[model samples]
Target: MLAFLYPGLGHVYLREWLRALVWFFLNVTSFTLLMPADAVPETFGWSELVAAAENVTPEAALALAAITVFSMIDAYWMAKRQNTETEVEEGTTCPNCGRDVDSDLEFCHWCTERLNPESDEAEETADDSGANA
Candidate 1:
């Protein structure tokens, strides 16, 4: 939501401070560079609109529009990536089948093999040896 509306907001929400800062800086720079040289009038009127329009360069406007669209897409992508990572963390990869599964599941969906049995046994042996020492 924030990211789509404001560049770099998604990164900030995702705790990626560096990305957020960089994105914000780039967005600001794009806007600054694209801004018209002519000063707009204090009052909103047809004359001011015409003047502003006259000062606007087509290439600059196009560049600014591109930057805005790119920022929105980047923010959405980062948000999706963060969500996918969260999902992965809450799930498990089946050792025998190499498939993603719920963390609570005990068997692999593809291979139908018991999950983590060998690793569990190895861990148990290591723990026992450490306790004995």
Candidate 2:
């Protein structure tokens, strides 16, 4: 929604200051390049702004709109990727319920299923003995 309002605003919300500034400047440059001199609003008001927007060429509007959509998608994808990375770092998935469970727990907190601590110990012991040999 932020990106919809202005290209790269979503990045600003995501704490990507440099990316947001670049996108904001890019969109501003595009608008300046495409704006007709006659379309410049003479007054600072809603009516004047609407008139200016109405005067914008279809090509300019379409280009800016495309950039806005692209920015929104990029922000959303990056946010999701960051969340996934954090989840991977902090925990493991419960096999029984296919949900995240804390790594420190002996069983799946969601499903309450035993995680075979004995087998894990046994494997560790076997590996240690093999290393000693």
Candidate 3:
């Protein structure tokens, strides 16, 4: 995915604006700080880093690009893992009684009507063995 090749894009796809902003800020800041200080003349904060990268040997450029690409991949993996856990949590809540239920439950454990009824059968089912005793 193109999102995995560019940092913060995956968060944007997930609609997490604050996370995207933080990821972009942190990556840019760290990249700026890690470049060799005297390798390039400073202009703006970012211009110095861009100049340093451009002036570097081809191997250095490749290494920096690889690092950036891996960071984006890490962000995408983290977002997907978080989204999956959230979906699982959302699906397991009981709608009728607001109780936590297993994902496979057909009816709320506290209220034993089908999740949806046909309207012909009574909502409540009586236990007849207790009555016979």
Candidate 4:
């Protein structure tokens, strides 16, 4: 998938903040390390890249190219897998009490109150009295 083609995109889609950050840092670091020394000094312009490639040994350029290609593939694959798994597990969590709820459920099972609707004032008063005992 195109997600794997670019690292961190998959994690972004999945809403995995830490995983996305790690993927971004890793891909960037690897790409930077694999690039030629001259390539590091300048903005990553096409001409600079070409000049570096022309100056560097063929073996170095090939290795760098391989690394960049492989990293892209790795990122894409990770994103695809994360997206699939996350979609299956996604559900709403209660903001007030931190309870997990099914997406279809409008109320928290534990609290037995309307999640997004107006709560009955009388019911709340009765519950409060019971809780104080």
lDDT values of the candidates?
A: 0.77, 0.83, 0.64, 0.65
The candidate, 2 or 4, that scores higher on lDDT is: 2
Q: Model 1, range 24-122, lDDT digits (tens) per residue?
A: 898888778777657435678998888887887888778766766776787778778878877655338886667788777778777898886977799
Order the candidates by lDDT, highest first: 2, 1, 4, 3
- Score residue 60 of candidate 4 by CA lDDT: 59
Best by TM-score: 2
lDDT of 4 by residue, 96-115 (tens): 67777776787788776566
Q: Which ten residues in a row are the worst by lDDT in model 3?
A: 118-127
- Model 1, position 58, has a per-residue lDDT of 83
Clashing pairs in 2: none
Best-fitting candidate, measured by lDDT? 2
The CA lDDT at 89 in model 3 is 65
Rank the candidate models, highest TM-score first.
2, 1, 3, 4
